[model samples]
Target: MSRRRRAEKRQTAPDPVYQSCLLAKFVNKIMYDGKKSVAQRIVYDALEKFAKRVKAEDPLAAFEQALENAKPALEVKSRRIGGATYQVPIEIPANRRISMAMGWIIQHSRAKAGRAMDERLAAELSDCFNNQGTTIKKKDDTHRMAEANKAFAHYKW
Candidate 1:
């Protein structure tokens, strides 16, 4: 029997304004109700605000730094060994790391009250850029959990 190959990843075009694929991915993640334009506007406005807040000459660069700071190096995965389940420490791939970081930023921003999405995203990005936000805490927690489960590293198949 032939084995099925993994599906190809759909390619995303860069954002019109900044021409950055990373920003476009972020916009797509923020999109609601199939509103791509609205998501783009919110993200662009937040990046502008982030630029001012971080005093960055290039907001995209600063945003990349924030994203880098939020990416977790390790995470624990459940593995069934014998009759017991073990939490195996595993390294995250680059794409998954980026996806997870973006999700955390959006989640924390959406959790905030009394602010527009752009405002909240801007604040959250600034916090992430400065390495002091819920997103960063989440990443840290993931790392800590993986570290605590390093004894199960051999269980990873």
Candidate 2:
């Protein structure tokens, strides 16, 4: 809530191999301590494994579908009106939806034990593509919360 002008949206450059902006963004999200090369290697490896796991001829398409499946359409936001706090349902914007999906996928993948990051990510992606995984479960939870809070949506400013 800065008083300054809104920041302009910066366009991400497409990834070198897939020429996909979404994939590039996903790689950037996976990067830690600015080690983009390591992140890219891991993500690319996961994509390959995911393609083989799902028997997908187009890994990018499969990955996109998995990401889409993990994206939540609605979320609940807390709004304070007349000294009362309420949970207001809100539609998520496009960029937030994509980032949330990527974050959830990465976080859920990282939580598993006894697996490399790439292998875990590949398994999670395939599970998500099939509409059954932690990410998708999180998405469903978000939608459910939003639905339950629909009565408070009028409190949105």
Candidate 3:
């Protein structure tokens, strides 16, 4: 962490094809070793696959809905007070919620075997859109943990 100053958030330009900043952010997160073009291709292909499966609707809409479905409302944070550790429930900020959803979707997609990256991502996205994927399950688990630990929320400060 930087002590002197908060880091400035670099502005991200919307993707060329979809013209969406959120999608651009997802693509950036998907990028590795600075291979943004490869990431873009993968994501675009995945969206196309998702569109074909769903039929009669925009894939971008499905992507956004999937992310929204995976966003967690609350999460637990560990805090120490008086030699005791507690799990404090905290509300998730909007930006964090989106980023977490995106990360989980990518992570779970990567975990699947025997498929190309685009196909895996498309499958995961479709699952998420229908609220039946690993990412949604993870979000539900986080909410459950937070609900269970609500008594410790006062220690959050």
lDDT of candidate 1 at residue 117, scale 0 to 100: 98
TM-score of each: 0.97, 0.95, 0.95
lDDT of 3 by residue, 1-157 (tens): 7679878989899999999999999999999999999999999999999888767278888889888999999999999898989999999999999999999999999999999999999999989888897989999999999999999988877
- Greater TM-score among 2 and 3 belongs to 2
Top model number, TM-score: 1
Each prediction's total of clashing residue pairs, residues at least 3 apart in sequence or on different chains, is: 0, 0, 0
lDDT of candidate 1 at residue 21, scale 0 to 100: 96
TM-score of model number 3 = 0.95
Select the stronger candidate by lDDT from 2 and 3: 2
Give me the overall lDDT of model 1: 0.95
**Model 2 over residues 1-157: C-alpha lDDT tens digits?**
8789988989999999999999999999999999999999999999999999999999999999999899999999888888888999999999899999999999999999898999999999999999998889999999999999888888877
Off by over 4 Å in 3: 1-5
